[model samples]
Target: MTAQATTSEPAASEPARRKTAIPKNPGRRDLGLRATLLFPNREIVERYYVPVIYTACRTCYSEQDPDEIFRRALAGDFDSLKMQKLIGSVIESGHGSTIEHVVFTFAISGVSRTLSHQLVRHRAGVAFDQQSQRYVKFKGAATMLPHSIAEGDPDLRTRYEEQVDGALGLYGDMLQAGVPGEDARFIFPNATRTNLVMTANLRALIHMSGLRLCTMAQWEIRRLFQLIRHEIFSVSPFLGSFLAPKCVPLGYCDEFNNRDGHCPIRPHKDRVLEAWAEKAAAARAAGRELPVT
Candidate 1:
């Protein structure tokens, strides 16, 4: 039998939950999300990269041997423009495995632990090695102050900074008192800065960029993808063009949270379906069938 609550038992106090406010117009500040591409420079891509992907794409359709195809592609036996056109068309058609032959590595640093936690969730075709909090005893640990908190009322901002500083100060005190670093690190806030090295294949990179570059994505993570896109553009604009919000390629937004259309990047999928329904209804009224794709 379930126990009954005693009349004298004190009621549990619930903390007020803060509503998540996605900034409609966030004033641009340099959020410290740095993504530096560490591999596949222009020379590297120009040399053997396209040939490898082209070979992968052609092997399925051509009677020519794979090695012979790679040989011709690398030696420029085919026009560069023609090769690029074919590759672009293949990628646009959702042949993702062809692009998986190429990879990019990045050195990411100075992002908050919150962002890192989100970053590590992409498991397939990506690898990460992050700085260890359990091992590295930080002497002067840094933290991120979100734009909202920084730009809010000065009194609230001051209080937030003081609370963070107070936690850090206590961490230092605990360490000085011979406490273990791992144990003391429990006090670190989610805003604490972190570093990571990430490597992902082109297919995985494009998949991640699609989700993270959307207007509805968290501002910090969205900014990181912007920087990552910039890095890819530096090396190869052709490949960089493919890294965009999923909605851009789909021509409509599918995020459940965006059904109200607060983010105006694209029309909501529900709205598009509703319009189609109305059109079909009108066609039915006219005793005709609406064409379907």
Candidate 2:
């Protein structure tokens, strides 16, 4: 007979692990970051957006030509609800190209250089044109003051503000003393505000939003996505509804940073996998096979 291995749980006297601290919500701020949808206004989205995406989806399975499918979709020959259902099904099944047919253009402004550095990391199916520091000499450059610093010890906050102002002041001094704008910009801090015109396909937008909208993302970028979601909702709530943290669609959180389960929005994937393993082992001990999903 084969011997079975067993494991014991931690002793009752063992100290409980300390829970990770959850980040405090950053309250509303006048922070100038704004995301404005620059293309496909409501009329265009209502009239042709769905049909265009539906055409892309249906083209894969139907014998009909793609343009004919789009024409019928636009003419209301196909049921609107049914088209949405099909599109949703295709999206959930990981058929990303179906949604890539649609794209959004956004005028992003007043964001810090810090956020821009992170934002540009997303290079797939996206394009960005940023306000050039070398070409555009900023007469008045703004900076971001994070909520934590603004609301912390008063002296510390004052020092932080003064430091930022001094950097901008030095930048201006350099420019006035015949320094090239490009050379003067060397004094700009990461908090310096910048502008960008970003264009991304639906697939890439969703993927970027999934990472940026999560509770674990940097506060400033998370807020930016919140505004982006609002802009999308203004054009088409049906499409905007799809933008959410990646875990919302995956049914479990995969972020290694959330392994301690502090966020509480969803169970960590590691815990879920461990639970399944335990269940399978118990089933085997009973001489029965556990079913896999």
Candidate 3:
């Protein structure tokens, strides 16, 4: 009898292999997205935001009470540059609690439900109030057309649009047929538009921006963060500067998908470690220990 053949197929419970290629940087395009800074305009941010964070940082080292430190900061008792420098250093040092004392509220609109789902996943130090599909039945509901599909083959684009429109038309028909709005909304696609009011502390904002600004992020969410960064910059460039890709501050890209170094914002961690190893090896060969920082 012939021996039974062996197979290398993956087990049924095993997860599918994920794509490794980092997505292309979706350069800013008009998606009709808007991110408006609703609270703490320029004057409020300038007058209070910095001082609030500064007081949090200074209170750590100073014997002075936080209220007194905040008062001094507000009264211009500390040199503006010096205060900013200290705040920057503390933030760089990963003393995140200091920055958590301040928060920014934004009115985000015209973003896809897909993006909103990702956005709400950030829960720490962030609060979100989103438009409800169940409570507010959408009339002539708007949907987002992804840049790729919008610019793809003419026939493909029409097909995509027609499918989405058909679903929306069915949703309306279901509603008219006495179906609950919640049930009708089951037909809505991820491309459906959503609005949210998000208020996040500086620490959470920085962390979220770091992730969503990365090239590996979905294009719609990346574009949302871009608009968010722009809004923050309009009020405070110093604060906005902190909202960058995680790799920018980490000094090395740690994304597993970026092993090919496709995103050029920074070198991959593996390469950085490899270079360090090589330097240490050369030092050892030369009968000298590599100095550690």
Q: After superposition, how far is residue 124 of candidate 2 from its true place, in Å?
A: 0.8
Find the 10 residues in a row with the least total lDDT in model 1: 1-10
Instruction: Show pairs that collide, candidate 3.
Output: none
Q: Provide the global lDDT of candidate 1 against the true structure.
A: 0.84
Runs in model 3 deviating more than 4 A are: 1-23
Number of the candidate with higher lDDT, 1 or 2: 2
lDDT of 2: 0.87
In candidate 1, which residue pairs get closer than 3 Å at backbone N, Cα or C atoms, i.e. clash?
none
User: Residue-wise lDDT of candidate 2 within 52-102, one digit each (tens)?
Assistant: 999999999999999999999989999999999998999999999988888
- Model 2 misplaced stretches (Cα beyond 4 Å): 1-24
TM-score of each: 0.89, 0.90, 0.91
- Which residue pairs clash within candidate 2? none
RMSD of each: 11.8, 12.1, 12.1
Output the better candidate (1/2) by TM-score: 2
The top-ranked prediction according to lDDT is 3
